[model samples]
Target: MASSNTTLAEASNITTMAGRSNSTEAASPYSFHFGMLLNPDYLLVEAQVIFSALSIIWLGAHASLRRPPSAAHAKPKNGKKKVKDVQFAEGFTASDAIMLPVTAAIVLVGLYYALEWFKDPDIVNRVLRIYLSTVSIASLGAAAGHGLDIITSLVFPGLWVDRKGTLYRVDSDHQHQVKVGEGDVETEVVEIKTPFPSFLSTLPLSHGKIQAAWEIRNLLTEEWTVRLAAHGLGLAEFSIKLNTLLGFLIAISTTIAYNTTKWFFLPNLLGSAACYSSFSLMSPTSFSIGSAILVGLFFYDIIMVFYTPYMITVAKKIDAPIKLVFNTGRGVSMLGLGDIVVPGMLMAMALRFDLHQFYHKQMKLEPIDLVSELATATPGETVMVSETQYRRVKPTYADPEGQWGNRFWTTKLGSLSPVSIATSVRAATAFPKPYFYASMLGYFAGMLVTLTMLLVFNHGQPALLYLVPGVTGSLWLTALARGELKDMYGYTEDGSMDVEDVIVEVDSTGKTIEAVKSTAEEKGETKDNKTGKEAVARTEKGEGDYDVFLFSVTAPRRRAPKRD
Candidate 1:
């Protein structure tokens, strides 16, 4: 009877202990399911980093490939021709560098106070959703276009055709001088009359026919006869190319899916598109400007993250596509867009510097004489004056003759057909990118450090604090080790040091027909027009008693012009 009682007592004690253990686990914050513990959150985090890095690098490479804005000109219209270039965003100025941190502080403080006052983020999110969604559509559309271009270039290089044409103002009916003959049978000059002033003809080539079914008077004043295979597929005014239309459709569909489902991957995809678009639309113009921006933001990030609760609070509460969020088993990890874009601008500038250096090393400038007619005080007579200038030999990439295909299929492996693997390898490894590679390595290391700190402290960390030093330090160190500090400092996107503009007219036969000169007196200009500095002009009698005005002045440090 005593043994039986002891057994019952022991069983009660065991049951009580089990119940206590279950209650403790239920109350603990760290309690998680077995499956949650086994979840591969680290892999997802690594993917986020890789995706961000690739997006930045791709943007930087393409930015380097873009031609100077001045090279592209709109076709002449209505008997008038004007030089116009589109600038997406202004380059960062010194004042902007100074004001960035201050502005961020103000904005963060406002957001924190507002959130505290409301005690609910739903109102703020609703308002932000309206604004951010609109922006996402535009940004995603542009990103889609870029993606289409890249994919087509890699997969369908043969489909691309390069067409050359001249632009002219149509004041009246136009004529073209053409040589008509068979082979070497003594070709005779023939004049062809046409309604348009300029047309480009590729012999024995006609992929499609141009139909002038309807014209919109003033809107259809300019004409382009270039035979590009990728033409529009709709009405003249509302026309969009096939590739462009497809890209827009994809963007729209993705956006709709995101709004409807609100899935995790959708936000990530949209966020990446936004980052790519930002890189495309904005630039730092020079290495110095980029450096200044990065350094300023470094301090801003440190203070907002460590000193105040606003950074983490604002990030968590904000329900927008501005941040990339990864769900870990414990909670969620967030990376802000500013973390990617700010340092990315600097990295992009570094890539451009690499390309600039490559061109400088490979290409040589050829001197050419520009002759212009200057009328003297005596009417009905003019004298010719010639000025010497230099023009750079075009790069191989700029050549339109089978160069695009060559970019992909240059190296052949024994007995292997030209494959897409070559495109990926060549795109990444073809460029000499000491600075870019260094920055990229630094960014990866910084990311690892940030993640480590987050795991150690179990707190939100300022990414830029690590990233800025990593990116900027690596670049500067590489430049120092290579003994290219002088070159690095000298390189700039500012056009102040570039050659002065000269207007030269050429015939279809590639002969210089006329050169136009604008005199300072005619324009009534006593100052340097571009730099807005003081100027002094001196006239001297040249050969044949022609007046030649020589301007000697200092070029002021003007704002760097922006370009895409």
Candidate 2:
């Protein structure tokens, strides 16, 4: 450690005329790590530390906001039933963390080597490059429009359907254990209905916009086209065709124009918007999956980037729009889509978790703890809770900042005595929420580290290698220092209660319904997806609204309730 620190300090020296002219310059491996005014090496280090520290602050605020509506230890009267808290998703389990990474590694190996095997196919590579570029451009456009999609879904009523009708899951099948004195809680079905005026009057022209666009499209179809052609009205038909074709032509022309830049400022700016959307929507159900992906990619990044120059070679040769490219006057600099995307996954997750936290606060409810069933756990005792069995049950507590604390401890000591291990037992930790914000801060810190590494190495560095530590280090350290490590480590998500009736992207592999295809002439039609056979159009709402409804209609299920 001391030697490494010395190396870093030595690297921080600015390249000067005196140093450059020195006779000993020939022996140096690098010009400078960070010779700039701030010394980026230290700056990068400080970013990791400071951002993580900020996360802890937000973690405390989020935790306090999410404090269970009812005190955990609150007492109940004799006849009172158990108050079941809402169960959201669980954190990653130990096995999942391991398995996900292994799978990703296998996949990455296949992709990397396949490119090498097909490296000689000049024609095939060209075809793929063009195709990928097109997709990237389109995705960028879609991403740019995604925010608008959400906004339109609001004004354009039929764009989204609240099948569950914004109902709340005050309780779910995955029960949160609130102590019961003696009797069962009143299981009488609780019906909650919320109505809001997202009505036509709010935005009067939303209907007009849809109607106008529809009319314009219909003018080019057989109904209008044939009528004009049959009457020998070639001029009218030609005018209509030209008008319709103009928009289509422009869209294509714009894509080609963007591609022709050979990666200038616009491509990077546009591509980033798409990348951001993709990252934000991916919620991590398991830290196991997130960890596996991050760690495996960490080594993969280093190997492909540094051990060999394969990654650099691919980026240079591909000529596809798979990365963000910038024209720095002298030349181009690039950041792969993965660099923006992978870390963004966690950043996005943080945002989602934040929204989730906000939902609890807005509703005046407690953030659900799914592991409440095992509330009373001891370090040395193995408790079978639910289908999952925890090997060691430790006392539940939070860090001093009142955040989810790590609670994992080693049971067996070899040089380690039983129950007396010297090293810390690294375990997975999860929190109800607010904890996710810390991870986000850590992500920013990691990104800075990645940038600093790029500057120092004067080549590519696998971002995850830096990021996994930046995000996880802060989470683990803050949690560990507060003596809440175990609680932080053992977090789980019961994804069964995830939001059901949200918009789906037809282009992406998500369960959300983009659109349901059905013939209005057919009766009692249905669409079977991964979930099961679901009715395409509810009979009552009928054909007109079905065309606009973006969410899938499945059998009634528990959902995380929403606030108006």
Candidate 3:
């Protein structure tokens, strides 16, 4: 490892010493990427990769050892055992399959154009164009994020975050009486909203924020809206004056900032983080989905990295915030967050699947189908959903190479129920957790291997080319050996709920009509609501942090400021 680092250093030093106008053009295996890091003179990216892998392992361990529902709501489905086997969609629908390529095209175009225009010297008023491009690309990226969520929904209905699936209702506030003046007691009511999570909405991660340049964006949007309203209302005089003044003010500020500072970081950081966060936390509802992402991205990375020089060219020239950057005094090393996030997410879900298995065994709860009639339940009460599960033994693919074919596990699914985000948080604690850790460990190991090879070969390699096999292969082998093959295959990170329809029964004689029973009536809606609310408040307070399952699982260590 040390020798590898030394090799990279010696090569970099030799290049620097040979200083000529064509230094960068004197190409080798690696090309200079833009953004904050200029050369691969440091091991920061490798360190970050290792750090994230370790974090994943630790999270898995913690879930196994520490997390379990304190009380498993003993409610059985139709007085039967709960089936932990997860149901999965056979394949993606038509629209979703098509969008996958559309997504790839959009990203490629954005990357090419972002880098091209940013570096073009002949372009007039470069900063203004940069801002425009940033907005356009960002909007496209957001659309892409939304599209991924839609794809998620196509497989597992209730998993998307941008939609509201959780219901948080307000009860009476908690009032604290305090003495204000000598004679008056001031009562302050603490407002509270109780979120009741259905099994479905609990798995995905989300955050809310706006950064520096975000302010400028809002300003531009509002100005355009105000101007449009004025003109539409026949206030042409006002619209002209206002639009001109606002435009002038924006132009001046943008020009100064772009000229004075490194303006690229804003969009760079925004785009990279957004993609990383969304993809990393978007858990797969089936083995197929995870496989699709890994297989797709693996080839995507390879083709972009080795087959064509475009990716490196853009990365080197843009010098944008698209990567998580760490600069050493000599040079910088950068890692694309995707390299950590995509595989890391799949690893995280495997861990959760293990955790759930642990609880089922420890508590001796029987497996029942997740049949859903989501009426309010008492806090700490596990509501059992008994849904239909259709499993079939199938070959991986039709191939003449093998005698018959490699067999795999798969399933079919119905619609999903609306679940609360809070349920996911609980499910995290209740289930037992594992190689999601091993895979994470493999990720760290693979990353080190990748870096070492980079040093030896002195050329760039597509990281996923190493990573896909390292993580996925390790998980596959481990699961097979441990007899957890069914567990892994059945592991769907779906927040799916189901309420069975049963309004009629028939004997051998004639059909008998039966009235549908109301679960709310049995539980007493009022009491159920109060109990559910109280339970929610307690869980919210006691649970403390659900983010243990979030990006933090592979969160990078905060680097200290670069040396002078």
The candidate scoring highest on TM-score is 1
Candidate 1 ranges beyond 4 A from true positions = 1-40, 60-64, 68-88, 159-240, 365-406, 409-429, 500-564
TM-score of each: 0.60, 0.43, 0.43
Q: What digit string (tens of lDDT, one per residue) describes model 1 on residues 446-534?
A: 77676555434434567787888888889888999999998787766664323323344555664545534335424546333533322
Instruction: Give me the displacement of residue 536 in model 3, in angstroms.
Output: 25
Number of the candidate with higher lDDT, 1 or 2: 1
lDDT of 3 at 525: 62
C-alpha lDDT (0 to 100) for residue 471 of candidate 3: 79
**TM accuracy, model 1:** 0.60
lDDT of 2 by residue, 523-555 (tens): 323222321233333423353332321222222
Query: How are the candidates ranked when ordered by lDDT, highest leading?
Result: 1, 3, 2
Lowest-sum lDDT 10-residue window in model 1: 9-18
Off by over 4 Å in 3: 1-45, 52-102, 113-276, 279-281, 362-432, 495-564
Number of the candidate with higher lDDT, 2 or 3: 3
Off by over 4 Å in 2: 1-30, 37-125, 149-263, 358-437, 476-494, 497-564
